[model samples]
Target: MKETKKKVVNIQEYKEKRKQKEVDRNELIALIKQIATLK
Candidate 1:
């Protein structure tokens, strides 16, 4: 039971990291678009 709980916690942390990376990618895309428009 304790091992399963640790696995669940690891999965949750991995999901959170993935979500943060996606957000960063979206922001980078937006910045690129803004710079393109400026040119």
Candidate 2:
């Protein structure tokens, strides 16, 4: 039971990290598009 709880916590953390990563990637993509338009 303790192991399962730990796994759940880990999964939640991984998901949060993935979410942040996607946000960062989207911001990067937007910046690139803006720069391209400026050129």
Estimate the Cα RMSD of every predicted model relative to the unseen true structure: 0.6, 0.7
Could you estimate the TM-score for every candidate?
0.90, 0.88
Taking all chains together, the TM-score of candidate 2 against the true structure is 0.88
Superposition error at 3 for model 2 (Å): 0.9
Cα lDDT of model 2 by residue, 8-29, tens digit: 9999999999999999999999
Residue pairs of candidate 2 with colliding backbone atoms: none
Minimal lDDT window, size 10, model 1: 1-10
C-alpha-based local distance difference test score of model 2:
1.00
Off by over 4 Å in 2: none
- Cα lDDT for residue 18, candidate 2: 100
Model 1 lDDT tens row, 1-39: 999999999999999999999999999999999999999
- The alpha-carbon deviation from the true structure for residue 35 of candidate 1, after best TM-score superposition, in angstroms, is 0.6
lDDT of 1 at 15: 100
